[model samples]
Target: MHPKTSSALRKVDAISKLLIHTQRLLDGPYRSKLSVSTDLESSLSSCKDQLDYLLRKLEVDFTQQPNGKGRRRDKLLRPFKISSHDLKWPFTKTEAEDIIRRLITAQELINRALQVDQINVVLSVEQKANLEKLPVANGAIFNSFEDEGEPECLPGTRTDLLRDLNTWIADPKETRIFWLCGMAGTGKSTISKALARKLS
Candidate 1:
């Protein structure tokens, strides 16, 4: 197999695995979180189905190629880019060609629907707004009257504590809890506020 073709196949395998895992998560705890209504589940399921179909189609297309050195192999391994022009269908139409076309559409849908970023899982506009309206830390509200405009952390102070906390965080099998202790006026709350800001 050509090197590029091998690389493309590997990527397809990785993406297929990720899609399957995402599908499972959707079926699991995230089902209610991701859903807009009953239809959101169906849409996510459809995306997973399309991704599976695309992966299979990609495998068949690559395998059917003779030695993976021909135009088909090159086409399959080509890098995707957004172009203003519409893609041209192959002159010689076949069932495989039709499958390939559908695969492209499926891949596009999956990309748009499943692309998650730093903002947790992918959410629709309405979902995002609803989530924002939710109180922080499970409805625990903090009054900002005195706490407003507080510094995220006390700069240049609590260096030792911060270092120890960072070490704890980086420890592979570390316990999940960290206890901070200090005398009454020793700025424990400030340290906590700083730590929360840094962590968040």
Candidate 2:
């Protein structure tokens, strides 16, 4: 075969493989193993085009930015301002179902992390907000735990704990207890003191 013909044949093969993979991506697993599909991959673009068609049919938007932030930032894709409006919504039902999936994923991740015990982690502002948004039942009573005695709180740490505690209280979840666990000398006692002052 001619050299040029060989190269062209290779491109065709690549495109053919891409089409088959992309069809699978659209059918069941939207969670792409690949980071991002390039525009040159016509199959990927075609799948997205199908997403756009379904979005238009429903009129909810496939890539509408929930907060007018250009595009709803995908979990893995950060610092990308690419508009989802042109990208596609995939399905309306998937949006809600994906939220539940993400929540379960995160909860499992947290539990798995806690199993290690030595690894301490902090939730990002957005993660914390989403966790707080988890629904609660009606008539759920919130009982604030109180420790009787002089608080052992230190300096301005009281201020920080007060802020966090106030937020926990403001939340409407059916939280029976706030497990403020930490190692010794990690200021758990200090925070307990601060909570006492705020409660008092």
Candidate 3:
């Protein structure tokens, strides 16, 4: 609870996370054979432990710096965090790490987005020469909260919803958040699985 001790812990946590993600980036694509010497998974496991420890430490009380006449942007800025608990499907630790990295990047992207009046993603080889060159939301996918709409009969037959998934794939721009309602006759999980497979 001491300020100095808490601050030191905070600093340590920040550096550890930075190192972990940097390592992940250096490791390159998932399951790349380039990973040698140190095992990829063991390293990840250690990093996860470090992160968990930090989170537990964070649960104790701490104080942020008092707002002063700092940079104007500092006053405007707000912290960003994704609610992992809200996911319909729970992710493995590895998946969670990737999601955390993405959420961090997305927070930065939104900051950049605010400054730039207009931003449209255009995929080009030349553009991907560097990290900054990469398009924001290049491969991002998300589901939305389904709103009130006319009940269109659940896609396809009773066996599987793979039939109507073709339509979902055709539209790349939209993020469909499906809310499955109704009785046993309505194929909720089936439709979700088919949509997931199609996306995959």
Candidate 4:
């Protein structure tokens, strides 16, 4: 698995655990007793902050759909007034229900993100294994031969080209195959390896 993705998964897992803890506090027998507990307030605040951070970091745009229908989806959580006192404790039953509802929604989103990441990791591992079974011809395959030095573009070179390739790879609308055609020794392999490393 990619190091960055692993780190993200850990963070998301932590957030999910925090949400669960908070939900249990609200549902437990000591709920009324801990209504004004500083710990409870802090936990709720942390949950809100972490959830917002993850949503932004993941770029999980609630307005967009995979089908390009341009229709907006329901928000993960309703907008709350931006004040520290906005999350006051001693929550009413209705307020507690609303909070639980939002927490469930956030958990659902987190689960979906985890599923997507797991799918990508599995696909990546399977693809690499399949590639390993293929024959290597003069190091034609990327990282196929350990003795042969891997081809990669030199640092500070092909900056514009790399940026364009990255943009094309990111844009869902630009799904066509990008052909990096050049002369035999014109560093096409190098550029390809560099792009692959960047994506990885």
Candidate 5:
């Protein structure tokens, strides 16, 4: 009924909501590899208990007081005072804010750690060296086609040819010899290389 009691109850609700949301984040979204550390989880549980106790004390002390203007409410609020000093509501509010801030900071740190771990994937020295090298080869027949850019298939150049070749190769009903007949420089070698790449 009193403003102070209402404010404290609101703060308690906020804190509870924050804790629930944080628990969901830790349990659901970050459940796999980015879970919160066990120590943090324990500390959060303790904070939750402390907040629950404070809320219950506030409810019992304020709501059960006899209807009196001045002395009775102060007397009821005295026994369960939040702090030794005068400020009651601010202390709990500040504490809840601090807890939420710490939880958010911990979440950010865990996300950053996950990003770093993903970036630093394990690779052998040979694999690393292979990644660094240019992905090109210069074999005998392919060397002749070096002038036509790297031996990768040019896009949209040989659709019908590739389809026919694929059909011939996949003809399990009969053994067949495929002949790709085209004049020189009509991209015969290029088609062959592309087909080889597709088959491989």
Candidate 6:
């Protein structure tokens, strides 16, 4: 097997284990527990963190629009919001079940993608051509040959601005366009390039 496929399979296995563990947690005696236990919270937190990491490793972007027979994949990649309080004991059973269902769906999608070969799994040739026609700003991306001399926020500089932008990106409620307006030579382009690199 190719190295990428092997790595993806391992991630899928990890996701499967997490799903099973969560289901068992909900099915076990803890399901009826009312007290908030540190152990339960830790377990839940670890599970969620692992799931997020695994999804990232698999390059599963919930933000991307799925096409063609990707309706199922789209459903599998549906984003969910969870706060720290959600990880506390006496957790919502329905929410836990929903998470398990989503994990299972994601696992299935990954398996199917691996089976069919990864290249162009989500786009057809015509769709690719259409996307190719979209205009992209030259040198707008960080580390491009055209912007090789460009610096990215000088390590630790613009920390607050970067944080705010990331928070805005993660927020589903803030659906408005994020206009990064600033005077020329004030580093607006630098910040944009940094953000683009971070997301990439």
How would you encode candidate 4's per-residue C-alpha lDDT over 57-85 as one tens digit per residue? 44432233445333223232335423222
RMSD of each: 16.4, 22.2, 23.0, 21.3, 15.0, 23.6
Clashing pairs in 2: 62-89, 63-84
> Candidate 3: where are CA atoms >4 Å away?
30-33, 37-40, 62-200
Summing lDDT over every window of 10 consecutive residues in candidate 2, give the lowest-scoring window. 31-40
TM-score of 1: 0.30
Q: Model 2 scores what on Cα lDDT?
A: 0.47
Candidate 4: give the clashing pairs. none
Task: Sort every candidate by lDDT, greatest first.
Answer: 5, 4, 6, 1, 2, 3
Task: Write the number of the candidate with greater lDDT, choosing between 1 and 4.
Answer: 4
CA deviation > 4 Å runs, candidate 6? 1-134, 139-142
lDDT of each: 0.55, 0.47, 0.45, 0.59, 0.60, 0.58
Candidate with best lDDT: 5
How do the residues 1-200 of candidate 1 rate in per-residue lDDT, one tens digit apiece?
A: 43433554565565566556656766786666544322344544665576566555444433333554555545654566422123322123465455445545655555554444213343456568987896676322233566666554556877998889888978958886788887896777777767666776
- Candidate 3 on 79-196: residue-level lDDT in tens? 3332222222233447545645644453344334323312222333334566566466532223423422323335455443454456555676746643457788575644554555
What is the lDDT for 82 in model 4?
33
Residue clash pairs of candidate 5 = none
Model 2 misplaced regions, further than 4 Å: 1-151
Question: Which residue pairs collide in model 6, if any?
Answer: none
- TM-score, cand. 4: 0.34
Worst 10 residues of 4 by lDDT: 81-90
Candidate 6 per-residue C-alpha lDDT over 1-200 given as tens digits, one digit per residue, 9 for 90 to 100: 22433444465577867556545655577444323222244445555665665555445222223253345444444454432223222224574445556656655544443334333433455568887998986646457678787766889899999999999999969967798898889998888888888999
Put down candidate 5 lDDT per residue, 2-99, tens digits, no spaces. Answer: 56667656766766776676567557754443333323576568657767666766645334334563355566558887322343443366765565
lDDT of 6: 0.58
Q: Roughly what TM-score does model 3 have, to 2 decimal places?
A: 0.25
Per model, state how many residue pairs clash: 0, 2, 1, 0, 0, 0
Please give, for residues 107-187, the per-residue lDDT of candidate 2 as tens digits: 343334333322221234456787789896433222333434434666665576678778887786838567888899877
Residue 14 lDDT in candidate 2: 47
| Collision pairs in model 1 | none
